[model samples]
Target: MSTTLVQIQVEEKRFRAHQVIDRLALDIRAGEIVSLVGPSGCGKSTLLRIVAGLETDYAGRVLIKGAKPQLHSPEVGFIFQEPRLLPWLSVADNVGFEAGRGGGKHPRVGELLAEVGLAAFADAWPKQLSGGMAQRAAIARGLFTQPALLLLDEPFSAVDAFTRMRLQDLLLSIAAHHGTTLLLVTHDVDEAVYLSDRVVVMNSGPGRIAGDVVVPLPRPRDRRDPALGRARSEVLTLLNGAQQDYHDIAPDIAAAPPAAAPIDWSKLSFAV
Candidate 1:
C-alpha cells in the first residue's frame, strides 16, 4: 500500500466571521498526483495555502510526512500562477535561490536546469525568456530542493494552450522521475483529468468537498482515450451539481447582512 504523504483535517476555517472551509478532510498518498477543481472562491487556493503553511489562521491539522508543514521548508515547494522569477537573477540563479550565496554555482542547479530543458539559458535573465520558459525555470527551482511535495496554484494558466500541454507533459515526466507528489489547483477540467490520478470537486459558499472523480487510467495517458473522456464527464457532472447547489443558496446569501466581524488583513502574517 502507498504511504499517506499528506493528511489534512480542517474542522473549520474562517476568514473572520465568514466561514471559508468546513469539515474538510483529505489524504494524499506518496507520489500521487491530485488536482482540486472547483468554481472560483471555492477555497481551493486557500486550501493549498494551508497545506503550504502560508495560511495559518485556521482550525486544522495538516501533516506532511507525519509532521506539520513548515513555511519555506525544503520538503515542500510552491509554484504560483505566475513564474514569479526575480529579473535580477539569471535562470540558474533563480533555480537555486534557496541555497543562498553563489546559488547558481550549485551542482543541483545545473542538473535541474538541464532537466527542465533550460541548461542553455542558465545565464539568461528572466526578462529575456518567454512565458513558458520562465515557468519551466520555476519548475526547476521548485525541484531544486528535491521536495517531497509540490504545490501548484494554476501554474500553467498564464501560458498558451500549446505551451500548457507541453508543460503538463513535462511536469508528469519530471514528477515520475523524481517520485514527487503533487497537489495542483486548476480550472481546466481537461488538464485536471489528464494530469491527476484523482480529481477532487469542491463547492463554494463556505467551500466544501462536493465529490471526487478517479481517473483509473495508466500514465503516458492518451488525451483521446475514451476512459479519460468518461472521467472528464464525471468531473463536469459533479461541478455542475455543485454549481447548482451554490445557486440554490444564493437567495439566502443575498438576504443576509455582511459579516459582523472582518479580519484585519495587515495584522495577519499569513496569506488569506
Candidate 2:
C-alpha cells in the first residue's frame, strides 16, 4: 500500500454536549475498500463527513492525497443512506451536475447512467423511478466526477434484501472497474464482510477503532463460504462486547482460524 490516499487523524470531535470521535487515526490506501462498523452514535457518519470535507468544525486533520480536503473536492464523492436525489431534477440533469466541478472532464452522463443500468431513464424524473433505480442514479451521480474515494453510509440499507445484494455486487463491480477506493459505514456485518477488503471495527461513544481485520476471501465471493462467516463472526464479536472491552477481543477474534466446514449458506441468517 502506498502512503495512504486518505488519512483521518483526529484527537477529538464534538457536537454540543455529545462527543463523537476520540483519538482516531487511520490510513486508507489507494483502491482499497474499507468498512467502518460500530454501534449508533459512534461518530461513523461524522468521520465520513470529515473525510468528504463536508464537516470541518471538528478538531482533527483529514488529508486527501497528502493535501487538505475541500468542499466539492472532485476527488471524493458521498452517497448517503437515502438516495437524496433532487426529486425535480431529471436523472440526466442530476448526473450532469458533476460537470460543473471546476471544468474537469468526466465520464459522460449517458455512459455513467448506462453503467448503472439507467441508460434509457436518462430523462426520467426521480418520482418516476423505482427505489432501486433511483439509488442507482444516485450511484451514477456519485461516480460522475470520477472520484478517488467513494464514501457510502449504508447506501443499500433502505432497499430490499435482493436489491441490497445486487447493489453490493454493483458497488464491488464499480470499485473494480474504476479502481476507486471506498470507505463504507455499515451496520450489517455480512454486508461489510461481503464487500470490504478490510473491516475496521469501532467502539461507540467518542468513536475509536477497536480492531482492523483483513478479509482474505477472494472477490466475486460466495456467500456460502465459511471464511466470510468466520470474518462476520469476528466482527460481531467485536461489536458484541462493551466499548471499553473491544480492545481485548479485537485481536483474539481477528486471529481466530478460518472455519473448515462449509455451512449451508441459506441456513445462516444475518441483518436485514
Candidate 3:
C-alpha cells in the first residue's frame, strides 16, 4: 500500500471559544488531489491551516508522512486566497523568493514561470500584473519549494470565471506533472468535482466530515462532460444535505446535554 501523504485523526478545534471543527478524520495519498467542499466558515480553511501547522491549539493529531507537521519544513507548501506578493518585487523575484540571491538564475525558476504563463511578465512588478497573473506568480512561488504536499485555500476564489477555469486546469496539469499531493478548500462544488480525485464534504459550523465521495471519472477530466455534471450534482446534494442537517441540530446543541454540563470557561485553556 502507498504511504499516506497527509493524515488527520479525530481532529477538533475552536476559535475564540467557539467550536469550529470537530472529529475530522482524513487520509490523503501521494499524487492524489483531495478537495474540501462546504459553505463559508465551515472550517475548511481552518482545517487546512491546522494541517499546515499554522494553528496548534486544535485537538487531535495531524501527521504528514507519519511525522508531525513543521511550518519551517519544506514538506508542505501553501497557496492562500490572495496573491500576497511584495509590491516592490518583480514577478520573477516574487516567485523565486525561496531561492537565495543568486537562485533566480536557476533554470527551474524560468521553467515554472513559463509553466504558469508568467515568463513574459518576469520583469513586471506586482502592481504591473493582472489579478490572474499575480495569482499565477503566487502559485509558482508555492511550487518553488517543491513540496511533497500543496495546500490551497480558495486560491481561485477572487478570479473571474474564465480565469478561474484556466487556473483550475493549470493546477491539475502541474499537480499531475509533479505528482504532488494537493488539498484544496473551495466553496465551488463544480470546481471541486472537476479537479479532485476525491471530494470531501464538510458540515457547517463545528465542521466535520459529512461525505467522502470518490471521483471515478477518468482524468484529464473534461469540465463539460456529462459524467462530470452528474458528479457535480451528487457533491452538491451532499453539501446541501449536510448544511440542512447542521441547521436542524443547532437548536439541540444549544440546549446543553443534561448529563454533560456546560463547559467551564474558567478551566478552558487554548492549546499551544
Segments in model 3 whose C-alpha atoms lie over 4 Å from true places: 251-272
lDDT of each: 0.94, 0.86, 0.87
Per-residue lDDT tens digits for candidate 1, residues 1-272, read 99999999988899889898999999999999999999999899999999999998899899999999899999999999999999998888999999987799999998999898998999999999999999999999999899999999999999999999999999999999999999999999999999999999999887899999999799899999999899999999999988887878785653457668988888879657
- In candidate 3 the C-alpha lDDT for residue 37 amounts to 92
Between candidates 1 and 2, the one scoring higher on TM-score is 1
49-110: candidate 2 lDDT, tens digit per residue: 99988898888798999999899988999998889888767888888776764212244888
Candidate 3, TM-score vs. the true structure?
Answer: 0.88
Residue 227 displacement in candidate 3 (angstroms): 1.6
Clashes of each: 0, 0, 0
Best by lDDT: 1
Q: Model 1 compared with the native: what TM-score?
A: 0.92
User: Cα lDDT for residue 156, model 1?
Assistant: 99
Once model 3 is optimally superposed onto the true structure by TM-score, how far is the C-alpha of residue 121 displaced, in angstroms? 1.7
Span of 10 residues, lowest total lDDT, candidate 2: 98-107
Give the C-alpha lDDT of model 2: 0.86
